[model samples]
Target: MTKIGKALGVLAAAVVLPLTLSGTAYADIPFNQPINGNATYYDNSGFGACGTWVNAATEMLVAVPASYWTTPNPNNDPLCRGVSVQVSYNGRTITVPVKDKCPSCGSGHIDLSLPAFSQLADPRLGNIPLTWKFVRS
Candidate 1:
């Protein structure tokens, strides 16, 4: 091939090769839509996985499942920004901010702060079945 033809082929391959090797990205969790899952309470002291300091007894906060934590840098995650979830259990419902990650939790599960858990059910209950959905904070 001529010099110009060789350069063009290399350029095309450089672009197309990466595109062919790239994997598709898709969301595993459905935001806004209601999700049924089990919720457990945790003490929110020190810095959370989202890199924010919170008080479990005072602030209504929740930790999303690691499977749903899309970003490597939790501080830059949009879910930890101004996003919150409305959790319903028994006859109670409460909205809480997304402030951390629950590495052991399943994709559909959530870890609520003590106060947030109390708002939905008795914190002493440890775990409770609930339905929740994302909401603007």
Candidate 2:
């Protein structure tokens, strides 16, 4: 199964309720971040590169590949860990934190926690186009 499929299975085992986003996106947050990508979520949470344990209930946790920390990246050692990120999709936005790495994900793909995913788009959508950028932690 694909990584997203596996994650979705994990999500199915955890919760199926969809979260509602409040209000519309604020244009002044300056999410002018250059990075944009697609997003997916998993059910059974696992350990992140940072050595922290996260689960489906963990709010605002995300994963980026190793490249996010290497050259051409500017966030520091743990990549975007602990950084508040603005994820926008379908005119809605939510802020989540970097929790792990997506070894199988491509350059612009993000694996988000179920809770965080719900905040951006409907869980039923499975996958969605998203744009994100680093914000003050």
Point to the candidate with the largest TM-score: 1
lDDT of 2 at 57: 60
What lDDT is reached at residue 110 by model 1? 92
Candidate 2 weakest lDDT stretch, 10 residues: 18-27
For candidate 2, give the lDDT of residue 90.
90
Error of 2 at 5 (Å): 59
Give per-residue CA lDDT, model 1, range 1-137, as digits (tens).
Answer: 99999999999999986554332112333568999999999885878877878877677899888876655677766676577889988888889888888889997799899888877777888999889888878
Q: List the residue pairs that clash in candidate 2.
A: 7-42, 7-43, 10-43, 11-43
Compared with the true structure, what per-residue lDDT tens digits does model 2 show for residues 60-82? 68776555554233332335434
Model 1 CA deviation exceeding 4 Å by range = 1-29
lDDT of 1 at 38: 90
Task: State which candidate has the highest lDDT.
Answer: 1
